[model samples]
Target: MEKEIKKVNDEISVAAFDPEENSFKSFAEKGFKSVINLQTDEEEQNVSPEKEEALAKDNDLEYRHIGVSEDKLSEALVDNFRQELENLPKPIVVHCKSGKRSGALVMMHIGCDKDMSGEEVIKQAEDMGFECDVPELEQFLKKYVNEH
Candidate 1:
């Protein structure tokens, strides 16, 4: 899979494998305050939400589990997730199976919340491999801006 882990930036990072699952124990040790997991347990090979929750709790980080799917990335869920996200502390690690869908959700959140253009959002999402091939996701995003 070419190691689906990278610094999307400095504060926000993405990964298919959790740092708690491997090296980089510093992320956990340094008291990162929150973790928003977009990954569903069944889809990821070795990731367990229970284990993640344990690690986060052990590190005193607040944890939220929002299990989004290719089939159900709807507007309502996005909005609700965004609301919850706004309440979380910084240095939040939002992750999914490959972090691609989480990146897509982040793009959608930016578009829906900050009035970013659909073209701008989709372009960023495409850079992360979160394309419009999925009908549900496309329809939801289209409703966000009335364009494909």
Candidate 2:
């Protein structure tokens, strides 16, 4: 819980650093009703999704794992993420290994939600220190923003 939980719009928030298995209680204490984990299962140090879900349930928080690896990011994944975000309880925390993936999706989701242009979304993300540096990722983000 050392990292700050950054506010992204009204209902969505993100942690500045990755959350360990034991961070669920702290998240619950911080009033996050849902936890969105963006880390892939194959990634090092990630506990099983079921374990994380159980931990979240133990803390009385909703949990969903929408892991999108850096190389595997796609429009469908972003769409799925948006659907999950819309359906989940409010005041959710989105987290990935370094917060980049979480930030990337947040920006895309907000871009559409706020009707921001692609450039505006990217600039907002960069201003928040969460630039989508990867070219492919950036393309998908812009595409989502532009089309959605």
- Candidate 1 lDDT tens digits, 34-104: 77788766665454777777767767777788888877666677877777667888666677766666776
Per-prediction CA RMSD (Å): 3.6, 1.4
lDDT of 2 at 100: 80
Looking at candidate 1, what is the lDDT of residue 72? 63
Q: Please estimate how well model 2 matches the true structure, expressed as its whole-model Cα lDDT.
A: 0.87
Question: After best superposition, candidate 1 residue 127: deviation in angstroms?
Answer: 4.3
lDDT of 1 at 74: 67
| Reference-based TM-score of each model | 0.75, 0.93
Quote model 1's TM-score.
0.75
Per residue, candidate 2 scores C-alpha lDDT tens digits across 6-124 of: 88877999886767777889999988899999988888745677888999999999999988887888889999999989999999999888778899899999999999988899999
